[model samples]
Target chain A: MTTTTATHRGFWYRHPNLRLAGLLSAPMAWLVVVYLGSLAALFITAFWQVDDFTGQIVRTFTLENFQLVFTTPAYLTTVARTLGIALLVTLLCLVIALPLSFFMARVASRRWQPLLIAMVLTPLWASYLVKVYAWRAMLQPESGVLAWLIGPLGLESPGYGFIGIVITLTYLWLPYMILPVYAGFTRLPGSMLDASSDLGAKGWRTFRSVIVPMIFPSVVAGSIFTFSLSLGDYITAQIVGGKLQMLGNVVQQTYVSNLPFAAAVSTIPVVIVLLYLAAVRRSGALENL
Target chain B: MSISRPTKLILTFLALLAFAFIYIPLIVILINSFSTNKSLTWPPSGFTTEWWGRAVDSEGVRDALLTSVIVASAATAVALILGILVSLVIARYRFFGRESISLLIVLPISLPGIVTGIALNNVFTSYLGGLTFLTLVVAHATFCIVVVYNNALARLRRLGGNVEEASADLGAGGWTTFRLVTFPLMKSAIIAGGLLAFGLSFDEIIVTTFTAGPGITTLPIWIYQNLFRPNQAPIVNVVAAALILVSIIPIYVAQRFSSDTNKGGGIL
Candidate 1:
């Protein structure tokens, strides 16, 4: 009986395509049908308009939503602000992550690497809302932590606005930047640095030419997280943004009353991310991610 | 790699500053959780555990906690099965559109969360009846699949096919080889992935906000709702402090089981 069962199973296993199909079908169905299908539905909805009087989504294809998103000054400014914030956050994360990751990967002793990495990663596990809330507490203009710490220096907290949002976002996404860049640093060949120094290249020259070029993909990988996350974040803005708005804030606000317009606003980020991904694909950053 | 003394000192200082930056807010949450002040004023006026006790006894907290746990567990389970299946195919078989499959797996996560949230929200409300617990699960599992898939794929690739070939060379059938060999080897990876998926699901807020039906409040949603309520603010701090404290365990465990020196576990 065992031999017969083994023969039957072996026969099925001999056909790799059958085995592949068996393995691939369920996950593919979920991904293509549910995930991709939803995204397509969303983009399709962008070309739709909501009837003003009836407040129903008109199924007819129209460029009105896209036009409103592009043409309205308020909407256009929101898009530009969101893009600026994402870029600033990504740049801040890079600046902060480069040194921190360098310290962890190169300056720190090997025995301490895992512990240091763990320390950086611990904050990531903290609830996102909680972290943003914490930032709220920290940024409370007059009596907040920032004011308490920096008041003696004649500097005040930026006080829950554009600067505050950027700071909080940079802090939030810094770990995402650090880990990949740290990995890149670890993968960097020590010999290359040694050769560069031996060839009389100064520290800045070696860093700019050799280190930057090699770790560029990892930096881009980290930037993807910072950029997209900042672009899509409404909660942070809501909690600490005061009167400031981003693309996500608009989407969240309009999603209920004007989903078509919301969908159109959302496409801006989607298009930006896709274009960013396509541009960075040449750097092989997607694989790094 | 070759650094001057000044550069090394500067890097070290910057790294410590970064660490401080990362941790100060969490520490603030911890401190404020015990503060007698309701507004969370700096220096905290005085320390007390009354909020902790209140949080422990809060019915809303309990219900939200239970809901989050259930949703996370279900999502993790679904993600585990899908992750294993997809990773097995990608790792073991050379097929057409293999690269595309990997990209497809990543798409749900790589895009901004708001896009994903609204997209799924549109579908759930329009075509799928309405948002429900099941909708939350599906939405979460979609993104959670990538975490598990990456871990499983890494482990499967490292495992190679030689062991399975050896098992087949013996009298073992395909199912037997998988049950007795492949599954066992992949167990740690699956656990690490599941832990990660659970974490992702548990902490998810943006997508959860869209997909969760009325009356279904996950922990993060609970925190968000309560964060602004003056009377509940201190309790919110207590919960946030508790989350930061409790999160260390799974992260540490995942790091240990992740086994890859280069990747530093599921965090990536």
Candidate 2:
């Protein structure tokens, strides 16, 4: 089991460095007690039965929670809506981030490229809550900036409820797309692009064929990040989607109000995420990186 | 084909428009914070810093802000430590469950925040005891750890094993080698990761909402409650604007550090 370090343990065996061990101890302990333990407890609580009407959980074990979650139309719809919105957001991020990332990588001067990346990265550093708050103010029905600008046109409310949430998520999480895309673009061999141009390939053609294939992994990485994040997020939907419930919201409500059922609903997204990850792993996409 | 000047200008304008789209609401709130009117009417009826004074004077806002600071600081520190350990182990050692461990550490980050929150809530409220400040810290740390670990592990990989070997060869123990060689190498990454963790924990609402019991409101929670206050709601604007103000300095610092690291072209 020790492999390379098995023989070396004798060196550290005599007097264990308390300072180094002390330094490492807290985080290791935290990982065990807080992270792994919490996950275990969460799993166990998910099996507990819940009382109807009052929305309290009982200690008794039952599959009723799972049954309720599977049978409920609202729960299914929320899951569908969550997945749909995440897909839309991922698509939107790709559409916007691709061209911009390409520009940063292929066109911009080396001196200017870092500055531009920093600019794109700024929104990511901003508080998530603040970004959501900003979006809320910008999308208010009457006095919103969009309403002010586009009121005269057919777009009376430019900020559609669920649509606004998707847009805001795209705006906030676009960096995830742009960063990987830019990295992929930067890693593109300068020789290949030159070869394409030398062969009389046009700019768009070169991008569509040569560039896209090379960066497909980055695209996958970015898409996975944005889609999963958007899918799992309940706040943006809760804050901006008005009264509409997404999977996140439903899971949240279940956690706070109905414990067992919420756990069951939560399992759907967890299984889906695990399945996706496994699929990605089986394809060796992550290993390729 | 060579790009024309007008096309360049148009592209620049479009980029600028994108920036504006993201920044306008933030700017509006900043501007509206000084409005004389109670309602958050766009462009403001007139200008006065009355709401700012009110926000500053309010006990609830102050307490919530303080609580947020305490929780964020505690959580970020915890996550930073955890991140260093996990990153070091993964980077330096070959363990049986290494790949799975890596996945587990990153899962909370890549998965939806709602899932993390709900999972944590179920654990804390059920098996664990009351939701105190420590609970919030633990919840925040769960996700925050990924950022630190990612940064640290990437740096560790880039540094390679030679330095540690050399230190040991020169009659240093493992701890000493780590201290003099590895720790110094990873300083900037740790700092960057810590700042990021702090920022994330500070503004995190989803997990905080689930883990925090009633009567212990964080700044985000408070802002959410006050968001639609029927009358005198501009105070919420003022608070939000103030939060933006508080965050800008650290956010800028974080961006600066992360970009510098990116440009340095070593690890990640």
Instruction: Go through the candidates in order and give each one's DockQ.
Output: 0.71, 0.46
**Residue-wise lDDT of candidate 1 within B199-266, one digit each (tens)?**
98999999999999989999999998987888888888899999989888778988888785245312
List per-prediction Cα lDDT, in the order shown. Answer: 0.90, 0.75
TM-score of chain A of each: 0.97, 0.86
Candidate of highest DockQ: 1
Q: How many residue pairs clash in each candidate?
A: 0, 1
Residue A106, candidate 2: alpha-carbon lDDT: 63
In CAPRI terms, model 2 is classed as acceptable
Clashing pairs in 1: none
Worst 10 residues of 1 chain A by lDDT: A1-10
